[model samples]
Target: MNKHNSSHIYGIRSILEAIIAEQPINKIFLQKGLKGELFMELESAIRKNGISVSYVPIEKLNRLTRNNHQGAVAQISPVKFHVFETLIESVLASEKNPLFLLLDQVSDVRNFGAIIRTAECCGVHGIIIPKNGAAPVTDDTVKTSAGAAFTVPMAKVDHLKDALFYLQSSGIQVVAATEKAEDDIYAVDFNQPSAVIMGSEDKGISPSILNMVDYRAKLPLMGNIGSLNVSVACGVFLYEAVRQRINQI
Candidate 1:
């Protein structure tokens, strides 16, 4: 799913209108060294909405949309992003045991969609991803999730580490799935209010975020391949929680 060829709005004015309307913008590509009142207004709107913006050359904006982009192009997200605090507060208001999924730099759109689908199926309360680096909710992603993208609550934050910290402070256990952990996934208790952090395919979880997590657990690899696709691993973790909760009741 290349956003370079995805649905986007061009022209600074059009993009500003979208921002003002609170449309779900996945990413904004602005021309480097751009300046002017309109650009200032666009920047202000972006900051207010917390939209992801990248300062790229005009050529890059042209590549995204060759339709009179006027130095700014914004890709629209198919699914609206929930605010981290608002999402958590809503879950707290529910009084049900919370299950949140956090993706650390998971860039593949298909994997992201599949993870969200599985999260929905497993009764995850919400999904979280960094505003930058993570894949946006595009049409293909929504298709891959079979409409789960709209059903599941998803949030985008400035940093995964801060979200992790906030989740801990809110009394939600932060469990990171990584190969580096000594404890196996089976050993970790997931019946508590929990947020599962799944890392990228190639790099796994970042060391800094891993250091902040309360517990690190891994799935034992019986096969020689030594890895599982991130979505598959995520489903395994999520269902484990489901299983634990079901039995507890």
Candidate 2:
């Protein structure tokens, strides 16, 4: 097993140690139908820590380790979380019109990383994603982001709808980018403080979160393909904001 400072643990004893150490586990993978006293103990510890776990085949666990992962492996995050209010307060203190991105179920790690890179290029003050539904910011996500992930402020909130409501109260217009929208994205002015919300490719934004958006705008798609990749679409909106912000200068 590869040594890690963040407590990468395997089957029974390691998992129990991780739980006892109070280390934050990004995720745990357990082989399905693995019956053992240790397995049950690890399962109990995992639940007590509130860590998310997935059941996979023993082969999958073997792939993660040549030695004994005991049908279990855990991935950990490198950074501590940031609070949404702290990010908002920092933006307000800067006296700049806060530009933000709220991601709704964008599970693709590369796409999420690319979006963060674009958001940084466009001068986005912060990026918000639901704590549960978003992509894992693993080593791959950070590598794909090309260090932009470190430079940008990211907040993971428990509920996206409530986060939108908070942003609205803070004077940031929440705009939803969906193909079902009635207006062109270009028609909306980005000079004002704004937050743009993008959804997963499989299903657009969830209705409850969609309803919270102040504006719904769509990009003009003339190609045979009806939609763009979420990362590319995010770049379009972010640069539009950049263009408008530049024009004002």
Candidate 3:
């Protein structure tokens, strides 16, 4: 296996070493039904770092690396994931109005890249994604982002529903984007300190999270397409914030 794969960390020792060195690990995959001292050590390291991990079949681990991964592989992120509390503190301390983007299980790497590019260009203070289920930043993602992925500040959180609550408690209006919503994008007040949650391409926002939203807004579609691509929808949502902030609309 190429040591330069950027996304993968093969072998149990190497994975543990990376964690010990404070590498930005996106996720870890372990072979199902496997247990040993090394595995226990790895699990402890993962818990200590709060890294997302999954138990998969050996075949899946083999597919990721032909090298002796020792039934474990870690995915390293290209950019260091920001700390949510630190990011919020900094944003709140800033003189400018806060504009944050919270992504809910948008699993496509290319889409993640595009959203990062758009969010950076739109001057979003930060991007928040769930630690599990979200796509890891890879070379393809960086290329798709036009290098914006490295510049944009992003926080990987434990759960998205909890994130919405935190944002609300911090005095930021939390708006969710969903087709089932009664209001269009214009109805929400984005000029204030705000965060907009964009769901995955397939499934929209979770019902529990959607229920907690201060507002549910949609982009009216005049065309025949049932829905827009998640990245495109994200761009539209962010630019609306830019427009609102520019015009104080």
Model 1 segments more than 4 A misplaced:
1-6, 32-35, 44-49, 57-59
In terms of TM-score, the best-performing candidate is 3
Q: What number of backbone clashes does candidate 1 have, counting pairs of residues 3 or more apart or in separate chains?
A: 0
Estimate the lDDT of model 1. 0.89
lDDT per residue for candidate 3 within 163-189, as digits (tens), equals 888889999999898998889998888
Ordered by lDDT, highest first, the candidates read 1, 3, 2
Encode model 2's per-residue lDDT on 1-249: one tens digit a residue. 233444356656776776687655667889999898988988998876556788999888777766677677876665445688888888888957889999999998889889888888888888988767678777777778898888888887778988988889988899999998989899999988999999997897998887779999999999899899999999998888889889999
Query: For candidate 3, what is the lDDT?
Result: 0.88
Question: TM-score of model 1 relative to the true fold?
Answer: 0.91
27-132 in candidate 1: lDDT tens per residue? 9999999999989998998887777889998889777875777898888897778888999989978956898999999999999889989998999889999988
Steric collisions counted per model: 0, 0, 0
Better of 1 and 3 by lDDT: 1
